[model samples]
Target: MIKKSMLVEKITRRTIGFVLTMLILSIGVFYLSRLAPGDPLQSFYGDAIESMSTEELDAARIRLGLDSPVYVQYVKWISNAFQGDFGLSLKYKMPAMAVITPLIGNTLILGGIAYILVFALATLLALFCAMHEDTLIDRIICKVGTAAYYIPPFWLGVVLVLIFSVNLGLLPSSGAYSVGKSDDILNRIQHMILPLVVMILSHLWYYAYMIRNKLLDEIRKDYVLLAKAKGCTKTEIVLKHCFRNVAPTIVNIMAISIPHVLSGTYIAEAVFNYPGIGALSVQSAKYHDYNLLMLTVLITGVLVIASSIIAQSVNEVIDPRIKLMEESP
Candidate 1:
């Protein structure tokens, strides 16, 4: 009963922390986006903004609720946000949430696939490297992975586009799906190939290297030596002992890495013109779509913050000592 109460208290504290963090994040994003030198009016009115009189501009700002002080605008936004009104995207002239809602699914599709592939491949690669450790295959993998790690995602994306889309015409160069063929799985996958490949390659080796090092470190631990003394072979020692111990570490790293892989997804979207939230993010930032930008950033923060909380919970399950450590006085 005591432990259960403590767990509830702990969860309550983290809930408060998450709310505070997001509140601060929204404030910062709201103020900084406003301070950035760009006319939100231009996004709304287009080239006509240039031809409007000063009085007309003033009226436009008033109409859009931008004539007030920054703090006042935030108060209004936060209140409206709680009521499910995120305002209009200046560029799209629609509810900001509506503008980005469909795009979120596209991003999830692209990001989810990349997330699974990168970690799965990295784990396999890490295991291979850990088992081989200093053999020719291991050295070759280390050198090649390091090289791939350094290559910029956008550059890699362009090269893939040129080779696959331009030269052989084997894959699409842009969009989440071909026009009006969104339901065709093959067509969607074809479009996703280049961007997804770039996102994977950009991050694959970096994580593989980290996981490889972690596995290697685990193999040197006293427990692994004991296992080996008990007649475990190299393969058995690594697969059974090292990998098991390293699983929690892998989960933790991958959780913290949400933002990193997310940024790569954004870069991929920009380069390939995939119609995801990442692409919308670029557009909103470029065009000063404040309402749209606010929602995008807030959504991203929710993902990152929620993932970290989930990681902690999972860690406590994987190793109860984590819960004990936190609960200790």
Candidate 2:
């Protein structure tokens, strides 16, 4: 009963914390949006905007509620957002959600696939390097991971496009799909390959190196030594003891990587012209589309909070001591 009560209390606190976090993020983003240079109206009228008189520009600001004080605007925005209204996109001149909703699925597919591949490849490489220690393979893995770590994603992406798409004519260079092509599963996969590879390569090296170092530290612990003395083979010790002990750290690292993954997704999508949130984000920024940009910021903020909550929950389950420690304060 006490444990149940503690669990309920923890969840309640987390809920409140997440709400506060979102609120603060919304406020910050709102202010920053105001600070961004250029009038949103310019996106609509371009240089022709100069022909409009001062009164007309003021009327346009009034229509968009941009003439209001910042705090009032924030209150209106937050209130409407709570009710599933994010206002209209200044650039697109349509409801913001109408523009954002479809692009979300594309981002999920791209980010999800790359995320899974990164973890899988990193885990295998880390395990191999850990088991091999200072052998030739371990040295090579370290060197390769270090090199990959320093290679910028944009440059790597451009190089891959030149090789695979331009020179070899093997893959589509840009966009999510071949226009007017049948939307078959195989066709979708072909379009996804290059961007997916870029995303995976950008993240894989850091994670693999981190896991290898952590595993090496775990292998030297007393528990691992005891297991070894108890007739456990190196593989058995690593698989049964070392991995379990390192699991919480791995989960924490993965959680921290969520934002980086999102940011990388944006860059990758832009480079590949994939019609995901990242590409939309670029357009939104270019046009000073406040509503679309705010919506994007809200979604990204929610994902970060969600990832953190998930990591905390996983840590608690992996070792109840974490729950106890958290509950203590």
Candidate 3:
């Protein structure tokens, strides 16, 4: 009962924190959108804002509600954004949702696949190395993981493109699909293979090494020794004792990695020309599409902050030590 109550308190705190974070970020987004030096009209319609007729200019401002006071504009925007409307894109000349929807879908697909693969493979490999600490296999895995982790992501992407797409010609060099004409699972996977591999290879090593180190340290705890003394099997001790204990750390690492992985996808997207949010974000930055850039940043920031809060709440729940430490006299 006490544990349930504590868990409820933790979830309530995290939920409140997430709402506060999104509110703050939305305000920041609104203010930052107004701060862009060049007008979106100039950037989108060519730098002839003064030459544009009153009708044309008013039409443009009206389209974006830019004619309103900043606070009023922000209030309306917050209302619409809550309803999943981000207004029209100045550059794309379509609803911002229209321009962003497919790209967001692509990003979620790629990011989700890579994150699951990285985390699962990293956890398994780390467990193996931790179990075999100080052995030849451990040394080799550690060295290789360290080396892979330190290499630049773009460099890895390039090398992957060169080998799989260029040299082998086995996969599409740059695209989310092969000209978008088929729904065959095999064809879709073939198109997905290169970018997915690039993402996994670029990220898996660092997480593997971190988890391995943490699990190794955790395996030496007195509780683990006591579990072993009770005649628990090796798998039981590692799985139930060590893995459960380290799960919170893994969650924390994943929460921190979410933002980075989101940003880092841009390199892979740029290399492969995949139609994901990362590529879209880069285009927005280059073209100075303040609205699109702000929207992307705002959304990504909310997800990252929410994940962080969730991780913290999970930490508080799983590790009663934290609550106790905080409550110490």
Top-lDDT structure, candidate number? 1
lDDT of 3 by residue, 84-140 (tens): 878767778777677887788778777878888889999999989888889998999
Task: Kindly list the per-residue Cα lDDT of model 1 for residues 160-258, writing each as its tens digit.
Answer: 999999999999999988889989999999998898889888899999999999999988889888888898899999998789889889999989999
Count backbone clashes in candidate 3. Answer: 0
TM values, all candidates: 0.98, 0.97, 0.83
What TM-score does structure 1 among the candidates reach? Answer: 0.98
**Which of the two, 2 or 3, has more lDDT?**
2
Candidate 3 wrong stretches, greater than 4 Å? 1-14, 47-64, 67-69, 227-236, 306-329
lDDT of each: 0.93, 0.89, 0.79
Query: Model 2: which residue pairs collide?
Result: none
lDDT of 3 at 52: 89
Task: Indicate the residue-level lDDT of 188 in model 1.
Answer: 93
Candidate 1 regions exceeding 4 Å error are none
lDDT string, candidate 2, 37-110, tens digits: 88889976678789999999999889889899999998998899989999999888899899999999889899
lDDT of 2 at 261: 89
Model 3 pairs whose backbones collide: none
What are the runs in model 2 whose C-alpha is more than 4 Å off? none
